[model samples]
Target chain A: MAIDERMEGIEAVFLDLDGTIYLGGELIEGASEFLDRLDHRGVKRFFLSNNSSRSVSQYLRKLTRLGIPAREEEVLLSTHDLLNWLEAEGIDDTFLVGTQGMGEMLEARGIRTQSKSPQAVVLGYDTEITYQKLSDASMYLHAGVPLVASHPDLVCPSPVGGLPDVGAYLSLFETTTGVRPVKVCGKPNPSMILGMIGELGLDVECCAMIGDSIYTDMAMADASGVHGILVLSGEATAEDAATSNVRMSLIAPSVDSLCR
Target chain B: MAIDERMEGIEAVFLDLDGTIYLGGELIEGASEFLDRLDHRGVKRFFLSNNSSRSVSQYLRKLTRLGIPAREEEVLLSTHDLLNWLEAEGIDDTFLVGTQGMGEMLEARGIRTQSKSPQAVVLGYDTEITYQKLSDASMYLHAGVPLVASHPDLVCPSPVGGLPDVGAYLSLFETTTGVRPVKVCGKPNPSMILGMIGELGLDVECCAMIGDSIYTDMAMADASGVHGILVLSGEATAEDAATSNVRMSLIAPSVDSLCR
Candidate 1:
């Protein structure tokens, strides 16, 4: 099938939150209309996000607050994605260096969390960091624990300013222990996209990834052989899309243009 | 007096242990004869070592086993040197990353050991290391803690092979924390030698340094404007001394030859 024909046959759609479907607490104009069109067409849809600061249920609640109907199962978060990957990889326990939300998520997935002699070190967005915690994590790394990071971003921009992210911690550990992380399970990596595709049982070529971050969203599409749509509602501007290595299949001012 | 005249006047001498006196538990042949000659001259002498792996009492025991007479105050260890320097600098409390020997030495000198919110990081040769210790040190560095390293040897040779020394750890931490040590108080730097000179109340030109390692012992003499005697008893071979950057005032097969 031709690229556009494959896109036309897309049985499932994966949407990125924050910059794609909504910004802050407001949905982009016509996001509901686009979802309604997908519903009418009988397409399976889900929202996959790299943000680990919030849980899937929290995202669902936010969607509800924004008048977008989202089921609990249809929202896949990085924390959940990591848990799934760990379970599939036969990792039943991990030394977690993240927030309580991530700890809860890991425990919910039947993974035991321990500070001593852990099989792997899982890093998420942690705001409550301490010197003791950093030392304990470094000890685990020095003792040769496998490392898995949720995302590769060095900084995450918030309402106030940019804060140190997973990449910053990774750099510190790498410098001290001379060991870099073996794998990352979010964003620009195609493994997460492929997992989403498998979970949704979608035809790969027809699926489109629409988001504001070209590095992650478009890169994921390019790597997974899916159509990429760049939207100007969030992080990336039109100029960023033009200079980006991942070519966009379509450009829309907002989700409103998709249905029109 | 001229350096040559001072060299002629020297009757007794002090020597550094590791890298200077002997390496890896083996006595430098002719070292015993050198000491015997110094004894015959009724020269006041002692041995100084910066290695903190063992206590002064332990060093005395080791020296006794090796057929060298050692008294408590006669053997000036790195711990002693550091304590003296700390007292002279008026630093009562310091964050030290070293062994029990270092801790004992600091305590004996009335210097307090504080790891958290440390005023400065005083590094020594620590045999026992953990990731937590390194992480804590990094945190202190990030918080703008002044770094003071005991020595600058990248690796210290052991009976089995070589281990990363203080310099290696400093290199790794500097890469991550963007802070290098402010001062190194060991051989090849003039401060330690000059300090020793001040303690002995000897003129710089009148003092002579005799040791096996050309890079450290000879270079120290060169830097301090003192006469240096290179002995073939420890780390450096005769070939190394010939090609080394350190210029020597005298070459001796052993301390016995120096007396001749």
Candidate 2:
């Protein structure tokens, strides 16, 4: 299918937030117009973010404040996937090294964020990471406890540049304890969006995965059998997408131009 | 030359400490006997260790406590190499993430170990590492300061198992900043032993590098034209040496068997 033609069949869209809709605190140009176009076309759209530092409520507030009003059901996070994974594995106790907001999300799900005898060590994008957390996690890992991470993004896109993310934290653990994460739940792991897609009664063929990062967004689309759409409004350049093996169904300059 | 034949011309020995001489607090079986044999043979022996958390005086104290009877001049440490490298580069200002003992050594050398405007981030086997140290190191690395590590040993051997070392800390910094060390001064670097060899007016071919690790001791030997001797009392098994690419000139059951 042609780049523009692929959009015709996309009845539902999974949109990445940070790079696609906004970069840091400022909203991207044409993002609102693109969302309006999706609304006009009766396309079901959902906001997906791999940043586990913020909870769903925080994301809702941020989105609303940015003029892109999002309901609770319409926003999905890696934290949700982490919660689901923990529940399925019967993991009620974990030593979590994440933000206060992330702590609340885990606690609300009945997962103890700080257990002395934790079954596993759960890692996230912890901007508030401390030495105690790192030391404790290393001790648990050395004791043969499994590790679970929220995502595998090496760096998060920022206005200044890339900032360390969960992937970097995972590397630290690996070097310290010679242990790797048993599970990483987020973008590039198809289950992040597959559950929501199933719940929406959406056909996989008519669903498009859209984002700025080729590795996470496009790779997830490939894994989940959704139409991968690459937006150049963020981290990845056209040259990057061209050289990458990921087959993007559509390559747009931005969501606005694609929608227009 | 045959494995035993290579030892015939050896006039001096460069011995690794942790696995070769002592395992934690206790000396390895026959370690004393091995040293006595080398002493009887009129061979000069130097203790070469990649463990940089301890200074030379601390190592001398530990050696004397263990009944090894080591002199200050007979001790060669990764810290010595780090100091030499710093001096060569004329770097007096560094952000050091190491032990208090290591801090004292750098300070004595007229090097600022805790400068806000550091020329480099110097890493060592810091058992007393704090989160503040790690966070500060990451910030400096992100700000484009070059990283210089004392050694590249991932884990230090302990009585029970392995403990995190400078290499582990280096991994953490790499993940957080996407930066690797500009220089790593320690075993297998050749310069660690080469300088002493030149000072002693000893031929490299007449010296034997004996240790338990093939990657460090034997690899250093290969790089500096010294006879490589492998002991089976530490990290590498006989099976491992059999499959490895590093060519060892001799293999022994332990330092005892090699000396005898």
Best by TM-score: 2
Per-residue CA lDDT of model 2 for B1-260, tens digit only, reads 44483266678899999888887888889889888978888888999999988988899999999998888889999998999999999999999999888999899999999999999999998877664677677778888999999999987765434667778777777877879999999998999899999998998878889999999999998899888898888888999899988877888878877655
Error (Å) of candidate 1 at residue A254 is 19
Cα lDDT tens digits, model 2, A85-156, are 999999998999888899999999899999988988999888777656777778888888899999888777
Candidate 2 docking quality: incorrect, acceptable, medium or high: incorrect
- List TM-scores for all candidates, in order: 0.57, 0.74
Worst 10 residues of 1 chain B by lDDT: B2-11
In model 2, state the lDDT of residue B123: 97
**Model 1: residues with Cα > 4 Å off, grouped in runs:** A1-260, B1-8, B253-257
TM-score of 2: 0.74
Chain B TM, every candidate: 0.87, 0.95
Ten-residue stretch with the least lDDT total in model 2 chain A: A1-10
Highest lDDT against the true fold, candidate? 2
